[model samples]
Target chain A: MTPDERGEDSAIDVPDALAALLGADTVWTEPPDIADELVARIEQEARLQGDDQPRPAAAGRPRPWRRWAMAGAAAAAVIVGIALVVNSADDDDREPAGVEFAIVGTELAPDASGTGVVQVRPAGFAIIIEIQGLDPAVPGTFYQGWVRSDDGDLVAVGTFHAREDNGPIALWSGVDLDDYPTLTVTTQQIGAGTGSSGEQVLVARFDGS
Target chain B: MTARDEMAARFAAADPDAIRDLYVQYSGPVTTVAASILRDPQLAQDAVQQTFLNAWRGAHSFDPSRDIAPWLYAIARRAAIDIHRAEQRRRTEGGHDLDVAVTPLAFDRTWEAWEVRRALGELPDDEREIVRLAHFEGRTHSEIAALTGIALGTVKSRSHRAHKRLAHALRHLVDTENVS
Candidate 1:
């Protein structure tokens, strides 16, 4: 059957609506400098990756089938990693609802901001934090989310890595939030233990409302 | 070899110049895709950078024999979605003025829009102009003929061909997505 017969409007004369949706005139225009800037950034990343590990020898190339097999293996590994995160987030044991807190920038990290949400249920609490506008965590360093109580005790919730593109990094935790009345995100060097790094970038107070 | 074939080879070889060439060719459409999702030009630019960086890192995985445009387009769309999610969180947390009346575009619909725009960009100048007139200008076939001083029959023929090509391209994208 034709698309029209199947009642699919998207298949019929898509160009007209598609053109309007894309804003055909304005969508194609881009700043002239963006290409150069992107190329420079890619080169920097390539150089950094190169510095950390030696390049594979140009000789001793594998056959096409073998190369394809290697690529498939690498792709599979990546898919597995992503699936792990997805599965963990979809765990059936967690509560399906939560209270959200706006995590604004502190004086130190003027540009940093994020949100922390705590889901409470009969089992426990599940906390999810989404952060953005933070600098990329340097090698051997990471950002750790902490919850502080009224009496000044700090509890480490979770750690996350920020990328250069400002893509939000979401960290999940199951720590109870009843005692902790405040949330603080801090930058910590690797192996800094579970203690507070004292370099807080974002803070939000929870009033238990 | 064609320019695209040469680019594919260079990309697989990790040639830095190829990275620049790919960016020049694809950045505009990538930004458009991002901007459509995020509704912010600056955030869209960030998505563009992320898209190309991802292309550069994954260049070795690309099949040189296949068309690079669709692959790059897919990455751009994903980057835009990432930005969209991030921006939504920001707006929700910042308590920005979000219009409740307007229905937000679904993720699949946004991807389709991006794909259509990318396909439209691949058309020849005359075909693109005809399609743009029909869609963007809301002109009928005869109106397009009168506006461009082309014959009515010729305008109708070109429009039919452009629509067919667009549908075929979009169908191919759907097939690819289903396979993967």
Candidate 2:
């Protein structure tokens, strides 16, 4: 309803006045450190996806970091109409709680199995995998996930480590799932190269419902 | 390091040094932003660590096309808000002391704080909050997104553009010799 919410240039003078008062650095942060923070947050969120257990709480208990991958592709409503989304969820914390996101591509290890629920909706999606009785893998190898098409082509939706809390692993990037039926999780080494080498872990089928 | 190589290197490596690099670069600003929102240094520190840790784990997901500051700041904002909410919950639930000390401006008349305050007032609440997070507390866009639970891309785009707008509005004051 508001002009700014519509992404239209509001009375330029008001914005200009605020900018003049704030000065350059206060407004536009060109600091490389901010870049570093961005890089670091993205990486951590990615690794958390493959984590199979709850990380020991740090001395400084930090808030959970969110990274929604493949949101643009999965949530056409949000992506195609970003402005409407911007207008809708102005308060990040107060926004809808149960919205699901899409996972485009992922690969699960052959032996991997358990129920995994992905919250896919307009904005993005998060993944929660429940490992029934499987023992967590050793540090060197991790359980990775992928999305697959109907014909069985693997798509790198994102990766994750198992968790103890039964909380779903959140994706940090976009996954390509144009012609996909399900998501797969697998075991792989940390530095042991690429793809799922250990075994199939689990799969989540999508009926497009 | 080549820009591409650096980005790739960051993507590949999740070492403490890499983490430290992030801390050194954005900590101060993030602290400032946290302080503005939470008004507590300790909570601010926690927000910073969480922000960086999020960055470390989520590195692969970040799009190179976007600037990183706003995204991080978004996280910081959310974290700060969370802290506030938790504190409020504690107060309401158990009747805890709500005597959180807000940092006061020293001069109360300094043109700098005044200008910032005035500009902050001029902004819409959302834009003002983003500005406060960036200028007063020092969060990057990614941190802001994580804290706020908003999309990282949206945080970066809006915060950056907001900064530009604020800067344009306040340009005349900063340009004045007396204010400088």
TM-score each candidate: 0.48, 0.31
User: Quality of candidate 1's docking, in CAPRI categories?
Assistant: incorrect
| Positional deviation of residue A112's Cα in model 1 after best superposition, in angstroms | 13
Tens-digit per-residue lDDT, B1-180, candidate 1: 898789878987877789887866666667666666665555565676678878888888888889887788788878777766655665678789653222144446555655666677788878878877766666667677889999987877777777777768777655555212
Query: What proportion of true contacts does candidate 1 retain?
Result: 0.25
Q: Taking chain A by itself, what TM-score does each prediction score?
A: 0.48, 0.43
Write model 2 residue lDDT over A110-162, tens digit each, in one string.
Answer: 34345543443332344544555454554334456667777877755555445
Off by over 4 Å in 1: A1-33, A48-209, B61-70, B97-104, B149-154, B171-180
What does fnat come to for each candidate?
Answer: 0.25, 0.05
C-alpha displacement of B141 in model 1, angstroms?
3.2
- C-alpha DockQ for predicted model 2: 0.05
DockQ of each: 0.17, 0.05
Model 2 chain B: worst 10 consecutive residues (lDDT sum): B102-111
TM-score of the second chain in each model? 0.72, 0.50
